[model samples]
Each structure stands twice: as C-alpha cells, then as structure tokens.
Target: MDFDYDLFVIGGGSGGVRAARIAAAEGKAKVALAEESRMGGTCVIRGCVPKKLMVFASEYPGLVDEAAAYGWEASAGAFDWPRFRGHLATELDRLEQVYRRNLERAGVTIFDQRATLADPHTVRLADGTARTAKHILIAAGGRPVRPSMPNAHLGMVSDDIFAMPSLPKSILIVGGGYIACEFACILNGLGVEVTQYYRGAQILRGFDDEARGLIAEMMRAQGIDLHLGTNLVEMAPAEGHPERQPTEFDAAMGMPASDSDAAGHAAPAAPRGAPSGPIWVKATNGSERVFDAVLFATGRAPNTPGLGLEDLGVRLGRNGQVVVDAYSQSSVPSIFAVGDVTDRINLTPVAIREGHAFADTIFGGRKTAVDHDLVPSAVFTQPELGTIGLTEEQAREAHRIEVYCTSFRPMRTAFIDRPERVLFKLIVEADTRRVLGCHIVAPGAGELIQMIGVAVKMGATKEDLDRTVAVHPTISEELVTMRTPVRTA
Candidate 1:
C-alpha cells in the first residue's frame, strides 16, 4: 500500500518541525509528523526552554546575596520552590499551545503517540495505524546518560530532574560538562547546596584552560562543594548511601566506562572543549561527593532506539549515533536522519539548519550540507562561558596557533566589591593570520561572543582585528583592541 503523503516526519522537535513545515509550505508534498509527547519537543518541553527558566530562577539567589555585599542590609532570603515550579508550569502550557497552533497552521497532521518505522517507508503508531510516504525522516533527538554508580538509578538525568516533584535541599552533580557546571551554578545560586563531583583534573576539560580555571575559582567561592578527582561508588536510599532497601530498584546506568564499556560499548568522545571524558559534564576532575539528591549531567545519547534504524540497516557510529553522509541521509536513500540522532552537530540551531538543508535538497532542489566548523556554543553558568572556533589546545594540535589572552574585572564588578574577574582569549593561525577561536568568561559572554563569532567565521585575521575600531566603554571592544598575542607556536 502506498503512503498518503509525500513526506512523513518522525519526532516533532526543532528539526522535525522545520522539515515538515518547510516541505509542506514550499513543495508539492503532503506532510504528517508523529511524536509521543507534546509537539514542543526537547528544547521547548524539557531541554533548553525549561532548563533556561530554571537557570533564570536560580540566578536570583546570587542577587539576593549580592544585595548584602553591596551594603544593603536585608533580611534573610527564602526560596519558594513551589512558586518557582508553578511559573515553569504556566510557561510550559503556553509553549505547548503555541506549538500546536504552529503545526495546524503549517498543515501538519500530528499523531500523539509513539511512532516507529515498521518498514523503510511505513511508520506505525501505537494504535496500529499505519502511514506511508515517499520520503521519511528521523529527528528523535537524544536523552541524558546517567552515571554508573552502584544503585545510581535513584538519581535523575537532565530530563527527569525537571519533573522532580520536590526540589532537593542539596544536589550532588556527577559529571564535569556544561550541564554539570550549569546546574552547580544554578542550584548554588538558588540557595540549594550543590556539590559537583568530577573524575578529572579540571571541570571544563576542553574549554580554554583559563576560562575553566576562572569558573572553578568562582564556583568554589560561591559555596558550591567542588569535588574533583573522585566519583560515586554507590547510591542508597539515604544521602550517605545507607538504609539499604530489600525492594529492588532499577539502576539507571549499568556500569562505569572502564567496567562495562558504558552499556556494552565504549562511549563516544564528549563535545569539543569538553574535558577528556563524557558530556553532561562542563569540565573535569576525578572526584566524588554525597548530597540529598544526585543528578547526572554526564551526557546525552542519540535517540535511535525503537525508531527501526537497526532493522533497516542504517549505519551508526560507535556511540550509536546514526551515520550519515555530508548530506544527512541514511544508508537507505529514501530514509533520512538528522539532529542529535545523527550526532553531527547536536544543537537546536544546528538541527534546524539540517532540517532546512534536508528539505531544500528534497524539495527546493538545493544541494547543501550543514557545516560543523566555525560553530559557536555557550554554557549558561554564572559569568557564562561562550566561545567560537578553536581552543588553544585544539589550535595547538591543528595549526601553529597564536593566542591573545586577557583577564580584567568587569566594570560593574569593579565597584561591586567582588574580586572575580572577566577573562577572555583569542586564538589565531600563525601563517594565514586568520582568527581561529575566541573565548570569554564574563557577565554577558553569550551576547558578546556573537560579534566575535561573526569575525572569526569570516576568516578575520590579526590585522583585521587590529584595524577594526574599538567600541569605547564596552567589554567587547577588547577583542578589536587586543594588540599582543599571549602565546604562539
């Protein structure tokens, strides 16, 4: 039986939605999308959106403390976890409705049930309803990977933690990635005791060494129990892993990477600038701690399970991410995979671009592939870290890189009486003079790094950076005015 539509999309997340909407609006194709959960997908429902809101809620905790240091004497502050949770609920509700309206407007028939490929072109719903299309796409995205501590099932991943019924008094995060650092800052800032446990030398392993150092110093000062060079041996009903229960509990993860190869296979290398280990971690240091709650910011795995990729012989990387060519297609031509599922560039915007490129190739007759280089990333930790292009470590390995690094207190911090300083670094190629990377750890590095990203992406050179007029009275001006290189090989 031939399918009804010209295009069918699975996993209605950022990538899925864009592909569906674009294919429908511009092409002569009918489209339908299937997702078990709400249409908003991971970024909107659990990943970015909710995580950021929680971050926003947590930021206030520092302000409350800063008030006192600035000579404003105020009463003790209290955190209303319930109130904060309520605000998140309201916002989630609004976003869900918006997603449905957008889909309806785009003429996408959304199936609110689990979808799997019964065959190459046929997708089956939970109710046994079947739909076939000329082309099929998988955009199921990824999920958090829990740590391998004994009885670690009790801990929460980035996804499940948001749905936690009650906020724990203290959180012990096990990992040294972006999520690990972000949560440490968030929980600590919100007045919840946070102890970060990482089994590596530094918290952010692959990030610029200086940025990682600055973050470590600030987090320790902010009261986060920074544990480096240790890991959890086990987890029990109690904080100390005592009070053994006779009843059986499912372990979230099977074993340590060294013990069981992380669930029957070696784990993939974490993100670039990531410490030498997995992601969900923002950095590294081999260590351990105990707390009221243990959360895994270890990393995420691609969502390729039950999507029928195995049955169809779709190629996969060692980490189980679907293997695709530069054009984002599976081994089977009519079947396409994108986003975290492909693990090419697992970012919301990156996924969106893949979707557009896929749709363009299929519908608009445009031949294009998403580029991984010159990609920019930001970690939402306090004094957030943002960077684009090469890190000094990566540049040193890839090219004869030159580095220009600086550290200065932010203007606001200068008067605020805190000793923390904003740190920045620039990496450039020694030969071509092209700017290879830019990094900043500061108040609004997320915003400031964008312009530098534009500069580095366009093959900006040392001379280009030197000749550009500095915008006075701004932190960003430091990029253009940086006259000397700190290190060169």
Candidate 2:
C-alpha cells in the first residue's frame, strides 16, 4: 500500500533518531521523526551529559583540598551556579542542533511536535495532521515519576536538577538508586548539606554487596548524611508554621526530639504574611529537619501515556512499557518499539543499538537483534562505579563461581592520607573459568569498565586475565594481579 513515508518514527530520542537516520540513509527508505521536546532526548539533553558535567564541576572543591594535601596552595571558592548553568544551557543547545543536523543530513524529515499512534500504520501529530507509513517505530523514552504521596510535588526530580535556577543550600535526597546517590554526592561536594534517605538496607541494590558497602561508607565519610532503613513520613512547607514538637511518647517510640517548641502538639498552618522558606520533612525514623529542597530520584516510567498505543491494541507491560520481541517488534506487525519505552536495558547506548538493529532488520534487509547481556554501565557518584556482566550474587545463584576481590587506598590519595579506597572484583564461573562479572569502585571506573567490557564480552577466562602483565602502580593492575580466590560459591 502507498504511504506518506516508508517509516514514521515517534519520539526523537537516541533510539528513534538512530532508527530514522539508519532507515533513511543506509536503507534508502524515506523516514520522518517527530519529537515534542529537544532532539537529543534524555541522555544528550538532560540525563547523562548535564549530570556528568555537574559531576565534573562538583569534584573541583575536593580536588582543591587534595592539591593542598599535595603541598600546593589551592582553595575552592563558592560554586558559581549561574555561570555553570548558563554554560550548560549553551552546550545542550549546541548538542540539540547537532542532532537535528545529523538527522537532516541522513535525509530524515524532522517534525518538532508530539506524535502518537492513530492506527496500526498511522501517526497523528499534535496538530490535526495524520500521516501513514509502511511501518512505525516508537522510542519515546522514560520520565522521572514522583512518589504517590502527599506534598510529593514539592520535591524535584532528576530532570529538574539541570534547570534549577539556584542550587539549594541543603537538600534532602530521597531514593537508593544511582541517580539519588550520585546527586547526593554532587550536592555534598558543592558544599551543600546533603541528607539522603533510602528505605532499603543499602544503596545501589543488585550490585556486588562489598562494593555497595564500600560506596556507602565513602559517601558517609565525604559528609553525606545517608540514612538507610529510613523514608519520609510527611513533608510540608516550613514557613511560619512551628516545627512539630516531640512528646515523651515520641521519645519512647525512639523518635528524635525536636529542638524547637517541645509542646508535643501539631503545628499551626502558615500565616498570611509568612515568608516563604524551606521544606519541613519528617522521616519514618522520627527525625525532622528543614531542607532548602527535596530531590526524588525514586523511579522513572516509560513515556507511553497519551501516545494512543493501547487504543490500537499494542501490548503494554505492567509498568506501561511497550512489550516487544527480541527484534523489537510489538504485537502489531507494522509497529515496533525500542529504548527506555520498551523497558529493556534502558541505557542510551543500548537504545541506539536496538534502533540500529530495527532499521537493519526491517529496512536494510539484514536481520539483526541486539544482545541485551553484559552491557557495561557506570554510576557517576563522587567515586564512580562501573559494572559489566552479572553481579556476584547473580552469578552465585546460577553458577558455581569463584570470586577474586581487592580493596585498598590508591597511591594518589593514600599519599595525601585521604580515607578513600578503591575496590576491584571479578566473578568467574568455576567450571568454565570464564569471567561472569566484573565490578569496580574507584575513580575512572566508568572508563576502565569500557575497556574491560570488551575482554569479558569475548569470553575471557580468569587465566587470560592472569596471564596479562600488570600495569605497575596502577589501581587497575589489581585486576590482573589477584590470583587467590577470595571465596568460592
């Protein structure tokens, strides 16, 4: 059947853009992409790029102190948020333009508006325009979701952090995931009083336990008020309202007492002329404090609402993610989905790969499917974390495994008497001797994991790693030098 275009891509995120570009340029198929927001999606515009830049900015103050320890006179002044934010805005604008130009060069038509499925092969833009296509690809990505609670809107999410006009003097970060932990460290390094609340026993769950424990310890040492087994009970605006006073009954329940009026009664509402102020949060642990802001990195959901997918009989998961086959094909033959919207490996690179594979299969006449296993990932906290393959716990559950681990202060910081330490661990299948997982907790772990990922993907065995010569005086050298098994499971 004749169509407006050979392919119509909805949501100009990393995945959608790649699919459109590939289908148009390589497959010689006409393509069009519509994006309601910026062209580069979460990774380029708001998530990775801006967050990493903030990570770099936050590190300087700590570096200045480290320089002082190294016999150099260096001291950090107050962070210039306005200056940095302005520069960040400019950089994001430049990146968005780059995405547009690349798509245009690939001969993919760009629509700077929202588009949603109207039928199996039709997309309706925000305007009253309907476009038909031989095939449609959905890659709308995901969004941060506020918790289902009272006054949850008072807290900001990860995306809001990039556009904040000013950094908060004190922030209450809520969550146990990478996003929450990273920002907790970022704010703390920038000299903000960072109080983190994670209801879980440990942050970074599903990671190697030892590594998680070490990161938690380092975060606390760096002055993050990380509270595990704790969560927010309630929060309200702290203007004119007297703080909740603690009663003897509260003390008996192990709740901390308030320093303010100890009347053991509820505070009155804000008065008419009361000046605006910070947030008053009461946690499950019975501690109450005021913070200039609250950040909720609780979770994210796929961008499927109002997209008209379910109306057309597209299968969606419990979390609103598009359910797809190995090749990213949805229930409808003419439709496909990828990226965070599919709830697969939700990394930007993974999405790009999925998009490329989709184009290759449907348009280029080369059937392709993305291998979702062993994708390397990094969490950009103060001290970064990088992991590939399975966690030690995951490996132990499935296979007889040998674990080799090492932890010590690196020379650079150890020389300065810093308390920071680095951890390197490898989980190997006992029978096959192949490395099943690698986890590293240290500076530049992200970069290191990328190189190590190649070896692990190629099915490198423990002996192969051992045979490689160690790079002397390097933190990563421990990866090759560790011979004795820490434990067998």
Candidate number of the best TM-score: 2
Clash totals in order: 34, 0
lDDT of 2 by residue, 1-489 (tens): 899999999988899999999999999999999999899999998799999999999999988999999999888888888799999999999999999999999999988999988899899989989999999999999998878776665667788787766666778999999999999998898778899999999999888898889999999999999999999999866644465343321222222223224563433322211212366899999988987678889999999999998999999999999999999999999999999999998899999999999999999999999999889999998688999999988898899999999999999999999999999999999999999999999999999999999999999999999999999989999999999999999
Per-residue error for 416 in candidate 1, Å, reads 2.8
Scored against the true structure, residue 382 in model 2 reaches a CA lDDT of 67
Count of clashes in candidate 2: 0
TM-score (C-alpha) between model 2 and the true structure:
0.93
Each model's Cα RMSD = 6.6, 6.7
* CA error at residue 298 for candidate 2, angstroms: 0.4
lDDT of 2 at 339: 99
